[model samples]
Target: MVLEGLGKSLRDVLGRVNSSSVIDEDLIKDVARELQRALLQADVNVQLVLELTNRIQDRALHEEPPAGRSPKDHVNKIIYEELVGLLDNGEGLELKPQTIMMVGLYGQGKTTSTGKLANYFVKKGFTVGLIGADVYRPAALDQLKQLGEKVNAEVYGEPGEKDAAKIVKNGLSKLSGKKIIIIDTSGRHALEDDLIQELKDIAAVAKPQERILVLDSQVGQQAGPQAEAFHNAVGVTGVILTKMDGTAKGGGALSAVAKTKARIVFIGTGEHIRDLEPFDADRFISRLLGMGDLASLVQIAKEEIGEDEAFEKVAKNMLSGKFTLTDMYQQMQAMTKMGTLQKVMSMIPGMSKMEDKIDYDASQAKLSKYKVILDSMTVNEKDEPTLIKGKRIDRIAAGAGVTGHDVRELLKQYNQSKKMMGSIGKDRKMRKKMMKQMAGMDPNALQDME
Candidate 1:
């Protein structure tokens, strides 16, 4: 949700281009101005905004559309390419055995990010450990320990140790067998000399493979200077931007960090540990332009739903018109694992534009209640909801601690799904096309079926 306003503004500009009868010099200028305004409003540096918009304007006015591409498509492509170039550093974190040292000012979510980073690696089947060398902040080690517990990673720290270098040495000795070791260093209110020296000492002792600077998204245009200073002091190799879900000025932080030529390794999209995502310029810009990040969606689905056979089974059931309340319940659980409904919607092309029209909170609450109601049902009831009559409905409502009306509403939803699936099943051609689409066999062929 970071830079939501900027995304909307850019999408609006593209919408105007697609709606216009003509793509002319005037339209290009107008688009450039709109983009300039959006970036500036997002707290991006004025000079950088001008530079980018000028490039966009030049390409839009001078470049000819490809043989099959329309003028609008050509201009959109140019904008997308420029935006990608602006953010991408052409580098990524090496996923081999390495020690990562986190450096940043205080209150930048460094400790939390350490946990998220460790979790990310662990999910990739790597053994990870955390070294809490943050001796300045009270209870920092305890916080890291708690997060380590949550992520099922080992945490190393000496409670009364005043020397961070000594703590780092000891942690390394303790967690030497781990594939990835992350050292969480102390931070100050500003980039003070002592903090820099302490980081230097810890780095010397840990001999980390990557030195990452953790930045708060709210830092806005200051991100560039901060990154530069840190890079100059201790040679920062990568950056992590945190609190991206809450900040309107996320564009500023991203652009500023990009300007420093530091590769952004990851971004914290939400508070959940699973909310962290590896930064990919193409996917990030695709989502911003309402084109969806299908790769990320697929990855999350694969993680949540297990093997490919499970999805095939679901597709077969839907095509056979045999979907039950149990299937719906399982789907809801998978969706929850993927993320919030709104997040899932945003990853779907064209659905981001409809976010305002949907009551996400109410829908989420309804989903929670439905799950609880389903939990109260027996296997027979889940497979055959029609078996539940007045008395049975009352029993389920009591068990689920909901009104009878709520149970009826859930049944109504199930009936709708069943009816929809039945219709798809009856249309053999449509069912085949749908299955093909789900299998990612041929999307264009499915569109042709329409």
Candidate 2:
């Protein structure tokens, strides 16, 4: 959600382009100016902003739209491509066996990101080991130990050990069984000589395949110089932008780091341990432009649900025109695991554009009540909702500690959902059409299905 203002501005500019009857030089220049303004407001470097806007203007005026594609669409596509170019395009760090050393200034969330990186590999079936080489910071080793427990990874640290390189050397031998090893080195309030030398010593002992610099997005364009300093010292291979959820200067950090040798490999989106995500510039831009990021959404669902079979079964049952209350309850549970309704919707292409129209709080409240009501019901009642007559409703409400009216409201919702799903399920032609559309849906038009 960083750079939300920039995203909104970009979307509005694109909307103007969509509304225009014709693509003219004036419109292109205007769009370019608006983009410059937005980028500047987001704390992007002025020089980079000018360069990007100039490229957009040039491409829009000279480039021809592809066959059957409207001029407006071509311009939009150009904008998307150009915007993506302003960020790292390299594939994220590979998932194979590797040792990674985390380096950054103090308070940049280096240790937290180390855990997140380890968690990422752990989820991918890698055996991870964390080395706490940060000897200067009090409780740093303890923090790493706790995070290691959270991710089910082993942590190696030596209490009262002043020599970081020696600790890393011992940790490597101790956690040699781990397929992936991540070393967390000490950080300073600023990148000083001692911190640089300490990192070099640790790197020498660890011989890591990757050195990651965790930069805070709030630092804005200053991230570039800091990243460069780390890269110069010990060859930082990748960067992780932290605190991206609410930073207005994230745009600056992103653009600045893109110019550095160390490309962005991940972004810390929230406080949750699972909120760290691999950074993909294209998908990121898609979301920023209000075009959604279905790939990321699917990835989140896979991570939360842990099985594609569950999704397939739900789809099949929904389309069969007959699904039990248990099925509905399970579906709701899945949604809850996926994330907030607002977050889920924002990933669904044009749905981000409809954020203002949605009553997310009301929807979340209703969902909670529905879940509680469903929980209060008997297994048989859940499987067969028709059994829930007057007495059953009263019993369920009392069990849930809600009014009977709330219980009935839930049933009404279930019936409405059943009717809607049934309409599509009972109609073979409609079902076929939906399947076909989903299989070949244009990424940009994905929200039409909603």
Candidate 3:
């Protein structure tokens, strides 16, 4: 969700062009102007923004709607395709045995991205290895070692070796069994000659399958120059953008790197080791425009919850009007496993806009509090809440170490959820529709609700 403001602005512009709006020249012009403004505000290069908007405007005005597609849908599709073309490299990484050499300037998150990348491959069942070739940074090897341990990947490093090439050569020999070997090179404060030369020497020794340049999203317009310099020096085959969770200038970095003709292989969405995701421009633009990215949502769900049969039983119970505090607690636990509520919410279509209206941290804390309150309740109270009167409420509140108001809030939420389940259960038509929707969901999604 980097460049949130820009995403909001662009979405608003699209919202204005509803089905009722006529697809005339004036409407296209207005949309083009709004898009230009949003891109500029997001710190995209002026020339690039103009070029993109011009192409969008031309296509919107000239392209004919396909069969069964409305004019509005056609224009929107045009914009989506153009934006994807602007950012995507149109190729995916070959997830086979390969040696990747990571290079970047200091403070660009090169070291952290190395760990994240290693973890990503490990999750895909690759035998990954990390080589600490960054001898200039005193603690680089230690950091890599810790990350390798956390991800259960092997680490090979000569802590005292001053020659980066020698360390890379030795690490390669030691980690020959690894399916994916990542060499973390030392970075400079700036793009200096010595850093470039060092990278060249290491590349010569390692003969990396992919020379990736890690650029911080906040680098803005400078991303182009930096990528060019790296490509000139050691031949950057791909780029990895980091710190994209909330960067205002992420658009600039992405577009700039794309302009360099180096494919963007991955993006660091958050600081967590599991936050690294493969870059897919189409899905990214879809999420940005409030269309959602169900693939990513399913991927995260698969990683977190897997295929839990408990969820299937819960779904059946809910359909049969058997929901209780226990069910709610179990559901909340599953949600907690799927990372932050905001992140989970943004993956659903129409929920990205809701993230701004809700306080995610406060909401998460409330969920935990609700679980604790539920734990303090007796079985009778959890199943038949009407059995609890004022005195019982106070006792439950005291046991849960919460105030009476908090207990009442939980009860209110429980009552609401119960009513919803009861309505769905009683109406056979609604139950059928719900089942159909659940059946359409990906099997790998959080849990199979059916």
Clashes of each: 0, 0, 0
Each candidate: what lDDT? 0.76, 0.76, 0.74
- State how far residue 52 of model 3 sits from its true place (Å): 1.3
TM-score (C-alpha, index-matched) for candidate 3: 0.66
Stretches of candidate 2 above 4 Å error?
A: 292-450
Q: Which is superior by TM-score, 1 or 2?
A: 2
Question: Model 3: how far is 449 from its true place, Å?
Answer: 18
Q: Candidate 2 lDDT, tens digit per residue, 71-121?
A: 877788788889888785577989899999999988888899988988999
Q: Which run of 10 residues does model 2 get worst, by summed lDDT?
A: 435-444
Please give, for residues 1-450, the per-residue lDDT of candidate 3 as tens digits: 466676777777777665345889999999899899988887777888899999999999988886756687677777777888887775756889999999999988888899998988898899999999999989989999999999989999987889999999998999999999999999988789988899999999999989988988887777777887898988888888888775455766766666677888988877889767778675567667654322223323333345344444455566567777777666666555443545445444333333354555665677778878888999878777888779998999999999999898777776656666666645433443332222221112313222
Per-candidate TM equals 0.66, 0.67, 0.66
Work out candidate 2's RMSD over C-alphas: 12.3
- Which 10-residue span in candidate 1 carries the lowest summed lDDT? 434-443
| Model 2 accuracy (lDDT, Cα) | 0.76
- Higher-lDDT candidate of 2 and 3: 2
Error of 3 at 343 (Å): 15
Residue 135, candidate 2: how far off, in angstroms? Answer: 1.9
